[model samples]
Each structure stands twice: as structure tokens, then as C-alpha cells.
Target: MLFRVNWRVKVPSLYWTLMSFSTSHGAWKWADRLRIRRTTVDDYEGVVSVRSDINRGCDYIPGTYRQLLKHNTGYAGFIDHELVSFMFAAEIDNGCSVVIQSGRIKEEYEGRGIISAMKKHSFHDLSRTATRSVSVTSSPFACDILLQRNARLLCKMERLIFATSRHALKNTQRSPKVDQSSTIPADDAFLKNIFLSSEITSTIFPENRLVIRGTPYELVTSNIERILCLSDQILVSKDYGTGSANLISFGSTWRSNHTDVVFINLFGESVDDKIIFEHVHRHVAGKTSSCEDKIIMYIVCTKQQHEETVKRVLKKHSWELLVVHDLYAIEESYSWMN
Candidate 1:
């Protein structure tokens, strides 16, 4: 097993609580309109007008006249005759978090605590819906409102344009160089290993699962960083061998003697992991490092072929490689981060 360390995912923007505000009553009354509480569907056009820019980017568009109306099972707040703020909350399997997604106030309504009022109302509504968390990506203005409202830090993932000290210590900040001729043909074995590993849920993952097919000789220092920063594993097919896994994970459940080992990352429906793993161990065993980080070259394949990769990886050199089972967990680790 190549597992070693584990790290947590941090959601950058979110609010823990909001200052109390009076609830809305009796329709969109201007005098008390600011206190009005209702689903966004009521003020569809108004909300869209207020958040024109934000709505444009939403899957259902920020203010798309409740095109995301179903998303409003919880709360949508309106100030008077116009919708000023709204939130969407959904509780699915793996994990759940409600996202304020979008909120806006009119030019004239900017400073009156209208957005705050809506946020306060939305929070309460989402809470009632059993929503444990929420996330918002864009809208600098909204980010502030959320912060002021007191969103707790779920996680803060920054784009480290440059390698961090930890990364440097691990020696994983570099781009990989794959010689064209050295590119391993996507064969039945390669394909099988990627898909059947149970690590992948589907072929074309919701998140991009990168699998770089190249020779080790071609992999550059930068390539190491890219792999460390991006992929779940590195696969070096025995027949097309060239690189070594040079770093360990922030956290790993797998163990490897090769300080610099190469693991594979593929998404296919073929099997024969034994060959792949033996290849990886053979190539990596040559490196001299004790950092124990598994920095490797990644290769993505299909659902079926993934099995072959694992088979080769696990059975290789008489079961020498510890096959890390779940790719989803791996993919999600660095893949989702900025």
C-alpha cells in the first residue's frame, strides 16, 4: 500500500451566524419590506435585476426566474417588491452543504442592511432544513457580507502559484516531460487498471482525473510538482517505464520503501495491475530519499481498464506494491483544491 498521510479540505468562504433581524410579515410592505421573508420565486425578476452579474454565471443563472426554483426548497428573501437575496440548500449522500450561492441588493437598497436581513433570514431557513454548511465562490461583495455575517472557515485553499516550503521539502514543484515516442499506448492492461480499481466512480469523472502517459527520462522537475499537486496516483507501465514517484502525500495510507516511487492514475476498464506495480517499484527502488513522499507520474484511463492497472500494480513483483484502493478520495484530495 502506497498510503502515507492525510489532509483536510478547506472551504474558503462561509458564515457561521448572522446578527439577528426581525422577520418579515404581511407581504411586500415597503415600510416593513426590508423585513419580508419569502422564497426567491416571489421576486424572481427583482432578484435577477439585483444580481445580474452573479446570476449570469450560475448553472441556473443567478436570477433566472426560479429556473433554480426547485433549488429554493429552503429560503429566498425579498425586500419590499424586489428579491434582494436567496440561498440554495441540498442534502445528498457523500456530504452536504448549503451555499448562499447568490445574494444582491439594488443600487438604492445598498446600505440599509437589506442584504444582511436576507442573509439572516436565509440562514435560519437553511438551518431549519437541516443544512449543516454552505459555500460561495464568486461575488466579492457577497464574500464581505458573508464574512461580516460571521462565516466560519470550513477551509481556505489558495492557488500556490509558487511552490510552498512543504512542497519544496518534498521536491514536487515541477512540470513533467513525456517524450512522444515513450508515450505508452493505452492498452487493454492499462485501461483495465484505471477503471476497475473502485477508486473511480465513472469514466469521465465529475472532477478531472489526470493520467499523464510518458517516460520517466522525459519527466522534468516541474513535472513532479504538477503530479504532486494534481493527480491521485502515478502509473509507470512496465513496458513503458521512465519516471519515479519522488514525494509522499500530505497524508498516506500506503507504504513504500522506494522514497521516490511512481504510482499510476488511470480511468479505464482493463486489468493486470501486477505488471504496472512491479514496474513502478523496480523503477522507484533506485532513488535515495527518506522523506517518504510518493511523488509520481499520473495516468488516467477508463472504468474497465482501471482494473488491469490495479491488478498489475498489486500483483507486481509478488505483491510488493500496496494498492491504494479508492481513487475518488485521491482525486478529491488535491484535485478539488485551488
Candidate 2:
């Protein structure tokens, strides 16, 4: 475990003593009312209740919550017997890394230091694991929380193109034809070439080494399958159909937590805005089974040109920009400062 080292003493004792004064004064309302405990199957209903009432969609599915509870590691904070917050961490890379699933607090409990307390409680458990890294994909605000504890930005999730409008599909089909190309089944070689391509290299983690350790081949293949299984087809383009040589783009569709996600996982070779939109429109329109309410499309881009192109083409397609964050911390001492 990472915290097995001598650094345990260095982890500040403020958390334990923060309420000492309140306890001595007999005004320790939180001391007795607020309690953090392991989440159990019996608590599922409460968790879901909190979720159903939340203003935003959950970060994970219901089944995931059950699985985390089974591990006896998922946590919940309750006050007056009302579940107010929850969190779970799932190990990855054979326990060398852990991806924090999600941390949530009910709306009424916000700004009460509930999230901070939950982090301290959960990090204690994670610190006892063989984890070497911790990763989280969250919104900008959530990223800020992770950042306070010494995690750094690995990458910003961007460059997504999506649309579900039947009109958009028709418009795309009739839209000015950029050269169109045939789809190629994604293979290891094809994906590797794209990964090593100068365009992708320049656009991904330009300031960092972009070391996505553990099962690159598996990650890519699984992503491809995620699209194929959720959507009817994968979109691949070569030379942007521009009659040019040595250009490639890859795309797929998937669903997450009841949201329809169209992932343009790979793109470049040529930055044809029309081609990008056309592919996304076709994928979304072709898919008969998407989420009941919304179809969320995403892409990862880091270049000014690609970002601009995506914004321009997707504006008319009911697309909205959402920040995707990749935050990480060391396994043992989750805080880099350690």
C-alpha cells in the first residue's frame, strides 16, 4: 500500500481535531449527526433516491453502484439518517491504478464540507491499496477538487462532434460534398499508425509524454467494440474523400449512464469540417437505439484548427461544448506534495 510508508504522520491531524472545539463546547451538532459509513445494498434505494432528485445526470449507472457496494468500499455520509453523499473507487491496471468512480453530495448538503470530509475518508482507504496512480474524468468543478489534493491535468477532453436531429441528417446528406471515403475496419496496425501520426501526436497532451499506461491495444480495441455494440456502424474516412493519399479518421458511437455518446476517437489527416459533421450525423441518425432523452456526442481534440472546425460545423446541429477532465494522483501519496 502506498501509505504504508512513513508519510502517514505527515498527513495532517487537522481532520480529527477540526471538531474538537465543537465537541468541548457541546455544540457539536455535526459530531453526532454527520456520519460516514460503508455503503451497503440496503442503501441502494437511498442512493438512487438522491440520484433521481439531482438536477444533473449521474456519472455512472445503477449497476456500478451495486458493484461498488459489494466490495464494501463504497462510502456514504448520512445526517439524521438521510444519505447526503457517496463515493467509490475502483482499482485498475491490476491495482496499480485506481479510477475514482464518482463523488456526489445531495443539493441541500452542498457547501457544508461534506465533499471534503468524504475525500478524506475515501483517500484513507485508497492509500492502503497497491495503487500507483489515480484517475478521474469529471467536470471542471470536480477537477478543481481533485487538483487541490495534488493531482495534475493529464488531458482536457475536447474535440467531440455529435448531432441527433433528423433534419441535420438530411441536411448533412445534401450538404456540400467534401470528398467521402470508404470505412476501414480498425486493426492494431491502423490504430497504431493513427496514434503515431504527427497530427494526433501534436494534438494529444502536447506538453506531456501522453503515457497512457496499461493495455493500449486493449483500450483501443474495446473502444472500437463499444461503438460497434452500441451503434450499428463505425465511421472511417481516408483522405477525407478528397482524393488525397495518407489521411485517416475514425469514429464510433456508444452509450454511458443512459446517455448516447458518439465518440470521434480518432481524427485528423485532413481537418475537413464538413466531413467530420457528416460522419457524426450519419452515426447518430443510423443508430435506432439511443438514450431516450438526449444523445451526447464527444471528441478529443487539442488543436486550435480542429477545435474551431468542430465548433463551426456542430453549431447548427444542437451540439454543446462540455469540458472533460483527466486528473491523476500518485497511488501511495495521492497528493503530489507528499
Candidate 3:
């Protein structure tokens, strides 16, 4: 089993205390005007507008609204004909699990229990399908809500992005040559061992189980494909011009805001922060002579694996800590029942 490390930090008292607060009265006042419904293509423009208005510079476009509306399922909160909050999730692993994508509520409409309401309705709807569980990469605020709902925290994820510019990095930075031939082994015993022996996995209730398939290589490939599909959506959602091909060095792109910004999940004994940033810089510089946009790459890691060395490397490169996310999984297929 991986060592049980108490990596959970003590957040501010107010932050913890507020999790249990009932939805604000204002939210109830607006409930009459708020309508919760499945999102459609027609709602895409409104969703983008709301996301941009709330996110500001940090808020990049969510490029997958069209796909989400067509292939996946999600709910949007529209109050007085204005799309205020949007939540979406995609079924993966052959309907064994559902992963939540992007979601947000307008600042003025926050703390009104809108999210709580949205989750209640959304999960209930998803449970009717074949989905056995649900997972989400949650921001601190979302983490609090999951905790309040007694959701299990699988791992804490830290998102760090490197702004790729030719001048942002020193030429000395270089990544080790990746062995293209040494593919992930055809067997998946490694993954089974990792998942079963994990202390975190042991804590999950027996009745609730996560079903998985394919060898580690197969699994990794599928995951990468999904990430690429999502990245394609981002590319279409906004015009950031063309980005470099090697923007994703190791795995697939995890999340993307604009052409310049992207994220990926990387795992290996030797993976380090310097190589990641360096790779992006090389690609972006190799593509354009003097690109100004900050090329951003994000990675998610558990608190335990997020070591001091990695943190130090990111800080040295002036990487931004975007989200202190806690990942969670609902144990049963019908999570709403619990």
C-alpha cells in the first residue's frame, strides 16, 4: 500500500465551517425564477458568456459544450432566461463511471445553494443510466461541498501551469529523450496492484465498486484519446491561433483554455517539473520566432506525490498554482441514493 500520509492541510476556519451552511435564502428567493434543464446546443453561447464573465483572465473558453450537449449529459441553471450555472459530466469506462467536466455559477449567484441543487438534480439524472460511480476534479469550494455531502476524497490534485515563452526558460533546460519504442506493457497487472493496494481505495464502501477494463497500456491510450478529444473542443471554442505539436510531451493534454494553455496528467518515477516546462518552451519557440502568449501546461498530482522538489521547480519557473483540487469518487452506481 502507498504510505498513508496526512497531506491534508488545515484550511481557514471559515472555509471549513461554511461547508455545512444551508443554501442561502437569496438562492431560494431566486429558485422560482431558476429553471434546471439538460443543456443543448442552443445554450452553448450563453454558457460560454457566463464562464468568461466570471472567470476573467483565468477563465478560458470551455471548448466542449457542443460535444457535451450531443454525446454526454449535463444540467444548466437558467434564471429569468439567463444561464447562471452550468454543470456537465461524461460517462467513461463503458458507463462504469462518470467524470464531471467544467462547472461554474455566476459570482453574484453563488452561495445560494445553486450548486447543491444542481448536483442533486444532475447526479439523480445520471444514476438512472448505467453509471456506477461519479468522479470530479474539484476546486477547494467544490471540495467543501463534497465533504459536506460525505463524499470520499480519493486524492488532492494540484494544478500548475507553465507559461511557455521563448524567454521564459533558460536554454539549459532540456528533457531526457523519451523512449518512443518502450510502450506501456501490454499487461495491466501494475494498475490492478496499484489500485487494490491503495489505502485510499480500501476506504471505499464494499457495496460501491469501480469497474475497470483493458491493460495498463490500453487504459493509458484510451485516457489520452479522451483528453485529445476534449482538447480539440477547446481549439474550436476559441481562436488562439495554432499551437506547437509537442505541447503535450508525455501523456495527452488534460485541459485546455486557449491555444496557448493546456494540461496533462503525467506519472513516472523520473518525471520532473523542469522537463515539463522545458518541453513546452522548446515546442512553442520551435513553432514561432517570438510568441507573446504565455504557453500554459497544467498537471494534476496527489498531495503525497506532490513533493517539495516538484514545488520548488515550479516556483523557480514562475508557474501559477491555479487550483488546489480534491478528487473524489462516489462509491455506488446510484450515488444519489446515499
Candidate achieving the largest lDDT: 2
Per-residue lDDT tens digits of candidate 1, residues 70-102?
Answer: 533434455544555544433221223333433
CA-lDDT, candidates in order: 0.33, 0.47, 0.44
RMSD of each: 17.9, 10.1, 10.0
Cα deviation at 241, candidate 3, in Å, is 43
In candidate 2, how many Å is residue 62 off?
Answer: 5.8
Candidate 3's TM-score: 0.60
lDDT of 1 at 47: 47
* Candidate 2 Cα errors over 4 Å, as ranges: 1-44, 51-74, 123-149, 157-270, 287-300, 316-338
Indicate whether candidate 1 or candidate 2 has the larger TM-score.
2
lDDT of 1 at 275: 42
Rank ordering of all candidates by lDDT, starting from the highest: 2, 3, 1
How many clashes show up per model? 102, 6, 3
Worst 10 residues of 3 by lDDT: 211-220
User: Candidates 1 and 3: which is better by TM-score?
Assistant: 3
